[model samples]
Target: MSYENKILQMKKLLKKNNTQHVIEKEPILKPDVPNYAGIWQDAGLKMIENDFGVVFLLEKHYPLDYKHGAIYLRELYDAFGKWQQTQNAHPISLTDANNLIFYDTETTGLKGVGTHIFLNGLLEESEDGFTLKQYVLADPSNEVAFLFESKFWQGRKTIITYNGKSFDWPQLQTRWTLNKKDLPPLKEHDHLDLFHGSKRIWKNDIARMKLTQVEEEKLGFTRLDDVPGYLAPIIYLDAVKSGQPDALLKVLQHNEWDLLSLLTLYVQATNLLCEGIAEESATTYTNIGKWYADLREIDRSEELLQQVTNQYTREEAVNAYYHLGFQQKKQQNYIEARKSFQQALPYLQGRQQIIALIELAKIFEHRDKNYEFALEMTKQALKLVTESSLWTKESKTLRLADIQKRKNRLERKK
Candidate 1:
């Protein structure tokens, strides 16, 4: 308030004397950002605008004969009869390929509040063929328009995805919460998340059940010059700041590749459910057999399990024998169950051996009513508890007491 105040007062007095009045300076407004869309016109990103805001749309059409991998694009439409035989009906009605949309998403992060979807890629079957459409969020602020425009599930019945049930769709739900007022009412559609199907089919066979790995192994095609998915968030965030859409263009291609793979993967996964077990691997036979058993399709389960046990011996498919025996037990086919469990005995040890012996004992006691065999099995289990060092001393003592009781019951029955 000392010398500086005096200088400011003199300056104000001189300025007022020089000018009759001081005009009010207008407030500065930020100019609209240009060239984010323009830079990608060569890359086929079309700026589509509506009431919500602007979204960058990139789309392509694959002809019917165009093959993504080993599968032609037409297989998605032509595989209807086989699709009808799949478990994808009822809950989702996957038989209707006409009402299908193959969907995938790339996000800023894995999960939680700050994570947002940057790309939503969808492929739909049309009369002409397959059309892949990718909607991009040019900036985080325009998420409303991005989601609004990319609600490709609006009229579709079932949306197929790799992991949309857990990750992608939940991210969309978070975005909808942020922009609910501007968005149209959400519609109900059955989700046929094929990630589960792939796991069921190839989890034991493949080391990692990642989509890219599956595409290379099962779909018979490897992605060339494709941007890694983990780098998507980084590439996109940099593009947002630098306004360089060139690097982001590769990410868009990665997304397109994902959508196309989803279509072919669906065809492959559905085929597994429909095909005969005779042509499948022992691993695939066991897998699909277990799947059928879980669905309570007893006949199909028994048939597939029987095939494995017939073709492969106990050492080759010990686990298969156990599954077959259990499935046989469920059907009250104890005669066949006894044979399978006996085959499993050679592969057993420790607690597993003890448990299998107890199961065999029960089959003999309850089904065969052979108390002598039951007592012998109980003695074997008792001997392990006392002799085997696989378990702790205290655990052995506890299990020893239980086996003693079982042996006493069997002796009394004998």
Candidate 2:
């Protein structure tokens, strides 16, 4: 019989065995037929089976002494407790590093029906050092199995991801719904999405706030000859169709590096925020100061802002002085506040300078009762606002009117 006739005969036999069996079985390639497990094993991936289906897993161990950039894996373990307390969620003390999981996923697309996660990467501290485990969906059919067998999510309190809150978690939830499976307990975990923190701390300092960009520029780590993330889905699909493990190996490597980078980024960010890494740039210090100010950590904010003021002589440092002055003024440290505002003047220009002058005017008039000095500062601010092109006519007029009123009040007091 011809090949087409034989295929038809096999379909008929399958229908006769179960007429309701309309689902076509995925074909195993010629190489895969002889040794199904050897295909993944040869690629250094181990096959694991569960109730739902089979998943390929790869595990790597890095020693405590292993350093990525400036941080040791052990330092990351040490910093998690402090980092957890600073997040917006209610503090759940994560002292044991084993309970913390750094997770990331590579999906087919950004969102909606067609997209599926092909790989899930997780990093956690182990007895020796750090262990990175990657669960690969060798076949799309095994995705449910992969999700079910993800024992790492069970009994773990904290999960750290770069942008997992908005993108990764939501995609997983969608996948669970599509598969008619319940969402994992990871939802209840103390999830820390580093994207928000990264933006708050490094937005001004970095060229771009992307994870890769942060890894390269801020953390001093870069991937060598790694596959770009955008090409991940394409490579994964080709691997699945062709039953070839080569492309999938690259995907796994890319994902493993991503997880490692996330661990390093987390450590670096925490160190900058909590332990205070020395020799940081002016903008980095200023951004951290602003972050602390937002958190109402007044002492930390002052310390970081002071560092920016003392170590740098640039436009960014002027903003730091302004923030420092504002914090000091809030604490009623009028002398230090006045000095900070004064120091900020030479570095500022246009609207910023005008604003600083107005602040100084207020301090002079209200706190020091130096009415003549206050009047002089107000007059200087009014002149700058009226002459400067930075402000709109209406804005300038309102500011000029406010400064003029201040000048009038100072004159009356004098």
Candidate 3:
């Protein structure tokens, strides 16, 4: 018989074989199975409700619409912006064991507000790549491997996840909350979310940095004959209802690939930061400097900052100058740091102009004891703040407070 005829035969047998309580198998209609059809909803509802609550219905496939995918991409972009602002404070690197955990998840849907996650996969480095322990809910009752109640995660340190900050972590936490189950103490486990990391390093380089694309490009791994991601939940439900536990192989493979891809992405991102091209190297140094600063390793932070300053282009040079100045100021080396800020003064404008003026004020007020010069610098900063409509309320308030406080201090000195 033809493939379509065999599939029809299998469907007929499946329809009759699957009852409310018993899982029956019809004889194999063909040596090889047919491609997956749109019977996932039928399988899922039956498994979930223990009754055939829904029937199979196939809608026209619209794989390229991507309206929801676009939203996800934009969300990732905004997340990258946030990471860029703070990456210097918490840089994503493979070396920081006290600051990393590999996290992955298997979910029924994408929306966190209402979607459900059927499995939570947490991985750690093993001999080869990563040892994954997938916490799955096999039936409605039995804990697949007793994962949810396992004490293995009790005091573990960090969670390194892709988009976990926004999605996976929150989803898992919400699931635990709903179950009223004790969640392993996670607050202490600092998160290094890799989605932002990947975007930061690859946004301009790759057309799409989706996990599949990254796996193909970076790791040279590709899926062959794999089930589509959207169909995973359907397959899982089908396997459950029919007790054809073997049907879960595809979904299991998908989940495993997701877990491994997260690791591969992490490694690739770290490698890029460590060994990138010239301009990219400068960006990496700047980002690494910020991460060290966040970790309170001022020496490492200063060294990385110096790397950026040494090889920086005009734009990078300006940012490097500002950061080096701030780092020196933090270390109480006002004289040298003042020179760094002054170096950028020619190109610095707007907010940067305001910041430079404030630093100069600090030099005169505290170091030089030149209160008159300090007062002049503060006045210039205040003027700039007034001129800029984009100045934040907090910025205006802080500037006014600093200027007035200096004025009072100067009065006392005089």
156-199: candidate 3 lDDT, tens digit per residue:
56677777888877776666555443233434457778777776
- lDDT string for model 1 (259-327, tens) is 889888877766666666545467777787788778777677777777787887667566678788887
Q: Where does candidate 3 clash, by residue pair?
A: 88-290, 88-291, 89-290, 101-160
- TM-scores across all candidates? 0.83, 0.81, 0.54
Q: Is candidate 2 or candidate 3 better by TM-score?
A: 2
Give the range of the ten consecutive residues with the poorest summed lDDT in model 3.
52-61
Q: Which runs of model 3 end up more than 4 angstroms from their true locations?
A: 1-101, 110-115, 119-160, 165-257, 268-281, 365-376, 391-398, 401-414
Q: Give lDDT tens digits, candidate 2, residues 289-342.
A: 888788777777888898787778856588898888889989999999999999
Q: Candidate 1, TM-score vs. the true structure?
A: 0.83
Better of 1 and 2 by TM-score: 1
Cα lDDT listed for each candidate: 0.79, 0.79, 0.60
* Number of the predicted model whose TM-score against the real structure is largest: 1
* Better candidate by lDDT, 2 or 3: 2
Instruction: Report how far off residue 120 is in candidate 1 (Å).
Output: 0.7
